[model samples]
Target: MVELSGKSDPFQHSFPNAVFYIPALIVVSAVAFFGYKLYKSLTEKDRKREEKLKAKQAKKKK
Candidate 1:
């Protein structure tokens, strides 16, 4: 490999290019986890509501 005197890269000693990778990955994963949890909670509430409505209807029919 041809080495340039002032060239910067991820493995270069002068500048750290890959430094932001880990923090960015962590932030994205955190957001995804919270989003998934919110979705699951919302769906669960809907499911419970539907179950209650069905039970109520059954009681009315009886």
Candidate 2:
């Protein structure tokens, strides 16, 4: 006689091991996006400052 009450199947109630990878991937992608945005903003600010300085120098030469 097979006993159904005492034995439990390992595959029937198993939790997924790779479930946390999804959130980790999302966090890493967000950090990369923010870092790229910061770099772009800083580069744009520096470029604008350079243009202003050049304009000032040209005015001084006039």
* Local lDDT at 24 for model 1: 93
Instruction: Give the whole-model CA lDDT for all candidates, comma-separated.
Output: 0.82, 0.81
**Stretches of model 1 off by over 4 angstroms after superposition:** 1-13
Q: Pairs clashing in candidate 2?
A: none
Local lDDT at 16 for model 2? 51
Best by TM-score: 1
Each prediction's RMSD over C-alphas, in Å, is 5.4, 7.5
Instruction: Write the residue-wise lDDT of candidate 1 on 1-62 in tens digits.
Output: 33434555656444354566778999999999999999999999999999999999999999
Tell me the TM-score of model 1: 0.74
